[model samples]
Target chain A: MDVQEAEQPVKKAALSKKESKLSTLTRELKKGKHYYILMAPYMIIFTMFTVVPVVVSFFLSFFSFNMLELPKFVGWENYARLFLSDDIFMISLKNTLLFAAITGPVSYIACFIFAWIINELTPKVRAFMTVIFYAPSISGNVFFIWLIIFSGDTYGYLNGFLMQTGFLLEPIQWLRDEQYVLWVVILVQLWLSLGTSFLAFIAGLQTIDRSLIEAGAMDGIKNRWQELWFITLPSMKPQLLFGAVLQITMAFAVADISMALAGFPSVNYAAHTVVTHLIDYGTIRFEMGYASAIATILFILMVSTNLLVQKLIRGVGT
Target chain B: MALFQHRRIIKKRLNRSIPVTIMLFAFLMLFGMFMAIPLVYAINNAFKPLDELFIFPPRFFVRNPTLENFFDLVAVMGDSWVPLSRYFANTIIITVFGTVGHIIFASMAAYPLAKYKFPGSRVIFSIVVLSLMFSPHVTAIPNYIVMSQLGWIDTHASLIIPAMAFPLGLFLMKQFMEQLPDAMLEAAKIDGASEYRIFWTIVMPNVKPAWLTLLILQFPVLWGTNGGDFVYSEELKTLNYALEQITLGGIARAGVGAAVALILMIVPITLFVISQSKVIQTMSTSGMKD
Candidate 1:
């Protein structure tokens, strides 16, 4: 009885503290209603389109939805089937990881290196070089031109050249052949991967303060290597991090190029990726639950890789 | 004196090595060729006579160039139910509205998050950054569901409205807006200006470069959109979607396909050329320092 009596006041005090905090929050909301108003249009739409959909997809992953019937709850079944029994899922996963492994780092480093080199030229030449480097990325569906270049017939550019040079006896079916499909997709992906990050790097290099470089020189920094390592890299951490995230996301989402170059469900599924697999299930099969499961796995893979890369980027020049 | 002379030689060599310059130039030329060949091939194919296009030992450059492909494109497009001009108009409308709407909404949201110390600003900004890592494909199925529910599936609103709040533009705008001085806002506040007034007069004008950067970045994405999975009506289709269909018409449409490809490629490339100078200019001043 004494303990109960003693706890009542403490509980009352805690309740009062909560009330005060709630009141302060209300006061803040009332004072800053304009900020909410300013952000309301975008926030409302963004929450509806992006945030809610992501949550819905996450929830849908645990069901047996076919979009025709009511979604039936089937906890862990979709995921189990994905991992244990689905052979194509395994293939898609392997292809996606391989694609990301090749294209992600290669394109990232290429973007920075080319941007760095181009930064050395005079402004007019730099502009020209930027266009040349950036043209392929902006050219819509221009990768389809590679189709003619790698055409299987003797008329094909690569085939004709190889045959004329006596490197091969017959023209090889590059896109149709399982051995060559993945490589060709990776090559084209790399070509197109220089879009945003390249521009960001160019901008980043251009923005480096000239005084800082001169100061570094006076402080005993010798050669361009030291300048790039200690000064330029450290200064452009934001752009680097930004570029890394974009590259990582793009690397994981390799559907469009793969689908375009190597026909969907390519021979032996050589060019099949997680995204293409998801598209097959989601759009073609209408297996919402399984597709969501695939999407969830991809989301986890991408976010985890991005987090790891972000950690590595933070340690740059330390 | 001899040691000093040796050091001078080394420094001069370090500053501008002839061999290194030659190596970099060589690399640039090789990479540039690799990047430019497909585009050059497409441009050349657009002008080639049909006979040349089908020739064995496929040539990189056209010996005989002509405008028959363009005329053929017009002819093929004329046979379609919807005129090619409608597709062009639809594309222009979508891209213009999408880009302009994205700029306005993104800047509006970005300004408050960047400048004001509101209670949820940090949380909102963090969400924006986190969303940057999410591929749109992951959300495509659910987004389709949401769009159907909103009755936006076949409408241009499906493309334009959702794109207006794209996290990338907001992220870029917020980052760019952070460079604006706070004192300017304070001065406007002291002069009896509303927040909207300040955002419109002071903030908008000051961030012209960021606006151009946003335009350049967003324009190509929307311009190249192939009606996505939303729009279905023939009249509502974009030029890119029409171009894809024509290309898929097989060997008969190859010449016209090349012509359509050139048309699609040229618009964005021209926009990039016109805006890239300003983008570079703005970005030069807006360096992201640690």
Candidate 2:
């Protein structure tokens, strides 16, 4: 044993010398070949479906292509038109930003807050509350329920309630009116937003070590707030980061709800979002290039916001 | 010294104040009602007699509940050119294939990513992370182009294959797999287990909770899918698309719409109820406490 231990330093010293990058990489590959095999199936399919399409979308953004004709090399003309010339695109952009600003941070914090609060309850109650919170997200097309509530006629629930209470003389057009459409859409979006992230937060809160809280108490962590701020938040960084990504993506992709609730091109485009505009161009007009440009802009915006949030999350307990 | 010890005991017992607990309950109840009303309304509407459904100051509760709407749904669906059973079959085939494929492929990918130290893993993971930020809408046009080029338009492959590599599944699986102890893997390695055997027998069984979570997540997405832009044939269309058509049949079909909505919602919610305990249990222990 002594002789083997004495020889280990000599062996390590010989291997510590500079080696060519190619040789080292080849050696590493040989050592980890099984991992490569395991990853191959998913990587291939993911590349074909996800990576290739993203690259194609980026490439298509620079050209002027209708579905029927060959793509023309317009060289940034589409993007220039999107930003400088198209008025509706600008409106869509502003509406999208406003939606994201309200829903993104608010929904994210709401998920964490509700998860935290729910964690303090009995196990049975916790499970029940989780289902209640998560139901809106999973129930397919149930946002249509909101449409019924916000219907323009007096028979609509919201209007009916208001009339009965003597709040308004006439039934208001809640969804059709420009003033209320965005707010209605936002409210529904927030309702649906407490989804996967909320589940993750619940799981995350559950995962915190009970012993750590005891340790904190022993260290004079005085109150529940302090215990939460120091012990709970820092430990669940992975779940927090996961929840943030889900919420951010959900916030930016607000087209479906707006389309479903407010009607497409919502009463003078008050509820028009970047994604809806992309859909209009891509599907309705078949202007693939211009649509690609809109998609690229959204992609960049989401990525940048994600990066910024990630940076901020890194300092959670510092 | 005795007083100090007594104060410590009080502090430990009062992890939360009674008022705070009451306030939290109140807040949860308020939001809970906000969340519950729409769903409860849908369920209540499903059973309401047609007259009750259309009444002004629309009743929140059904005065006379009946299953006539469900029967009416069956009658309307019966009149369609294609059989309702065919649509149900189509939906089941797509959902099962899509969800099972996703769980398998995602876990396969996530295992290597979380457990192995290899070249390009970091780059690949970052790509996965980046993909999570962009909505699928961004890729829809290009994906359609790719689909047509591959002659996958109108084929079930268009739906199933794309869902197989969903980034969220991979992300969740990887995060869960990271919590596994490396020493356990090493012990398996020492026992002459092949990597495949290790992953299949050891790793897969350990991550059962994540499997359920992925199922709960992926099933609903596939279940609600209307076959998107690719599918065109009536026979190949899903139940959701069929339901959408029935719902759009307008005021004449409102009762049926509510019934179909209830039908669409029941399966996923049931799945959640069954799997939620495991999901919550899994997630509660998922935080990396370091």
Candidate 3:
């Protein structure tokens, strides 16, 4: 009888603790009730489009569904098919990784370097240079000029130049040839790559305190590189990280240029990417389940890379 | 004044090495030409007559520039089932609504996320950051479903509403807003100002650069929207889609295609140029913290 009485008191004490926790939560909620109201509209839309879509994609990856019929349970069959039976998937995965590996770092470095150099110029020249550097990225649909340049006939600029200079016996099929298609696309991508990251770097450079550079000079920093390494780079870590994420996302999503320049399903899938593969199944073939699996894999790839890069960026200049 | 003079001297002395300077200039000029030549060529192509366009060993510059292509574009556009003006109106409607709506909602959402730590704040922010890593390509299939279920498909709302929720704008706006001094908000609160009043009058005014940055960023995106999967009606199509269709009209329309490209790019480019300084100023504050 004494043991039962003691246990009852302990249970009552635990219940009171739970009640307090619930009360505190409600109190906090009440305190920030206005914040919740402010956030509601954006949160609702964000939830519907961005958050819900991602969650749905993740869930749908496990089922087989076309638009017309009910989704059927498929277990891991779609994923297994992607890894095991699908040769095109392997090709796409390889191409996407290769494309991202090349474009991501190259474009990122190029953005920073151009911004850094442009910052050294006088303001009038700086603005002019900024406009010049930023022009191609904003120039919509003009990358088709690259198509004209790399055209197979001698009339194409590249072919005409090479032939005129006697560097080639015949005009090369730049976009059609498997060996050259990826490289051509890569070149064009680099040209168009100095985009948001470039602007961000410029802004980052501008935001750096002039006093810091003076302080570094006082501390006996020898040259521009030292100034950049010790003072400038560390000050703009946030911008650098921001640029990295943008570049990584863009690098992985290289479908538009490839589709336009190299032709979709380029010469034997030479320039095929994960997104292109996704579009193939998702939009054209209506293999929603398979496409969802592709998307989920891509999502995992991008997020993991971003996380890894974020860690590396945090270690910068330490 | 003396300190400023001394700083200038120090900067001059610590200037980049001569060899590095030369190398950098060379690279700058090289890339500058590479970037500018295509655009210059496109501009030239737009003014080229038909004969010049098809000339062998394609001419870098048009021997004779004319407004023929522009005239042709007008004529061709007149033949379309939907008027070119309708496409323009559609684009204007979409771009204005999408960009403005994004700035307002994102700023509203960003205020609380930036300044206060309420329930689910960290979780909500983490989700926003996570959304940034992946491209929208992943979300297309599911977003289409969501749009249709909401009865938003085939409507301008499909494009405008989703655009309002673009995570990067919120991410950047929040980052910028965090830099706003808490003391200012606290003082406002002490004055008995409501949180809504604080957000609208004080916070919004102080964060002009951030919203301007959002405007510049979102403007180009919305301006260049092709209304990919969500929009399908001919009347509902954007200007970019219309121009793209014109360009796809085959070999005979090559001159018109170049003209179309020029027209397609001109508006956003002009917007960037006009707002370049303000946008950069805003972007200066657009840094994310760890």
Candidate 4:
């Protein structure tokens, strides 16, 4: 008690900027030490699963790694080969870009249209409509979609339905034939995107500034068409950006559909994604180094696209 | 003056109406069919035996209905790639713990990041947000290498731990946590509660809806483990793996495969029904927007 009384007067005299920061930091730490302990386990797991894997993959990219043989440092050879030698790699990259370009916007537009229509409906109807779309996303019932689309035999659901409705003369080998397989993959992805994207768009619409619509109305804008073009769309820019980025990444990175609809070696690799390619070579072929190289390229491409999208979004905003 | 006013009213009402209503209706019907047709087939056929499932023109409604498929689920499911029970158990384990662990850890990390801003806070938070931009599929190779290094292949750690820090959950949780009043936490702190104690006792009760939201949102993904190289071990397989194992059996077992899909949809659909409100709210909060 005696020591504390003497120390307060000395400490209370004044503090330099550095001392003030030191004291503030000390106080913050003392107040929040328990939060750090709580966060430690999660941080550890995040680092192990996410951060460490990223680092290991980066290093592995430099090595010519086969699972059986120890990784040997090859130093840019994998990247050089990916650029100079690999034709399939380039095909995969092109396929992914085209897929993203097509599906990304179509699905996003679908989301907006769906949300707009649902917003026009009454709440109960909107909820029911939401359930109709979102249930599939929730169930993720991939197996059933597989069943509907790819029934290889004459009696397969899609083939049978198309024939019965007279859309085709014969059953199509949707997965087996390479020429038609990419479309099949795209169709499945479109369906999945519809559910998630529509749901997200609905949420976004709900968050919009209702007053902005009113303001637009006061400016003599009274029609739905005028409202959408001038007020609604601009207000939804962030959500739109989020959906676009998400859809593109998911589109480029899609492997599950290819895996489900057409298994490995995926019908002459027609539906092969960069992801599936990495998994196939790194995992199945056990070529870790080459897989890492492919993956690094993918990482670079995705990050670059994100940067460009952000720039574009910024432009749109301003 | 009356004539001019009447003309203004007509012009206002006319105001260049759009004619896409018919097209919108057509899109609605097409999409509704696209979404509902699969589930209808799964359920309608689930109740039908082998003979009806194979019938030509495959009638929309089942001609014969039976509990035979449900009973056969246990029997035929066992005979597939891995035993159905093992894979189902695996799926259950991954879904339950992976989701629960995610909510807990993400909540903990989310609280400080959302409510408290320390030095390096924005930087750390941005990194988490950045992780969300990169799909997990892109990281599969890297994660595989890391998992192997830890000798964690063919174990629950591979499936469960990585899922715990998933960026979407963290982002959503952080956003939601920020919406909560800081006074609630402050009151608990003043009452002399520990941080963990405050989270579990004070914060968790408030966040029940979010946890429930995450549970329903995450179950399908967690349970859909496949029998790939990264997850082929007996202890590591999920219900999806079990389903794959069955379909991989020659043509005779196709019936069993359809049955498993029917079963897989049950839990997720059930979860969706129970947490319908919370799921909707979470979607409203987190779904894409400006």
| Highest DockQ against the true fold, candidate | 3
lDDT per residue, candidate 2, A1-318, as tens digits?
999999999887767654456689999999889888888888888998889988999999999999898999999899999999999999999999999999999999999999988887667777788899999899988888898899899888999999999998898998889999999999999999998889889888887887898888878887778888888988889788878888998999999899988899899999999999999999899999999999899899998998888778876776
DockQ, all candidates in order: 0.46, 0.48, 0.58, 0.37
Scoring only the A-chain of each prediction against the true A-chain gives TM-scores of 0.94, 0.91, 0.94, 0.86
- Candidate 2's DockQ: 0.48
TM-score (C-alpha, index-matched) for candidate 3: 0.94
Whose DockQ is higher: candidate 1's or candidate 4's? 1
* Residue B150 lDDT (model 1): 94
Pairing residues by index, what is the TM-score of model 1?
Answer: 0.94
For model 1, how does the per-residue alpha-carbon lDDT over A1-318 read when each residue is reduced to its tens digit?
999999999999999999999999889888778888888888998998889988999999999998889999999999999999999999999999999999999999999999988887766778888998988887778888887777778877899999999999999999999999999999999999887788888999988887888788788886777888988989888888888988999999999988888989888999999999999999999999999999999989998999899988888777
Taking the tens digit of each residue's C-alpha lDDT, what string does model 4 give over A153-233? 776778878898899998989788988888877887777776545656787777778677666777888677887878777
Report the interface RMSD that candidate 2 achieves against the true structure, in angstroms.
4.7
Comparing 1 with 2 on lDDT, the higher-scoring candidate is 2
Positional deviation of A279 in candidate 4, in angstroms?
1.2
CAPRI-style quality class for the chain A–B interface of candidate 2: acceptable
Selected candidate, larger TM-score, 1 vs 2: 1
> Interface RMSD of the predictions, in order shown?
4.9, 4.7, 3.5, 5.9
Docking class of 4: acceptable
lDDT of 3 at B30: 90
lDDT of 3 by residue, B87-139 (tens): 87898999899999999999999999999998899999999998989999989
lDDT of 1 by residue, B249-270 (tens): 8878888888888988888888
- Candidate 3, after superposition: displacement of residue A246 in Å? 0.9
lDDT of 4 by residue, B1-290 (tens): 22112254244433333345545656776887887777777777678877876677756678878777777886865675556787777778888888989988988888788788775667777777667677775567777767778888878877888888877777777766777889988998899987778888877788777787677656778866564456656756777766666667745666666678787876787777677667556655663332
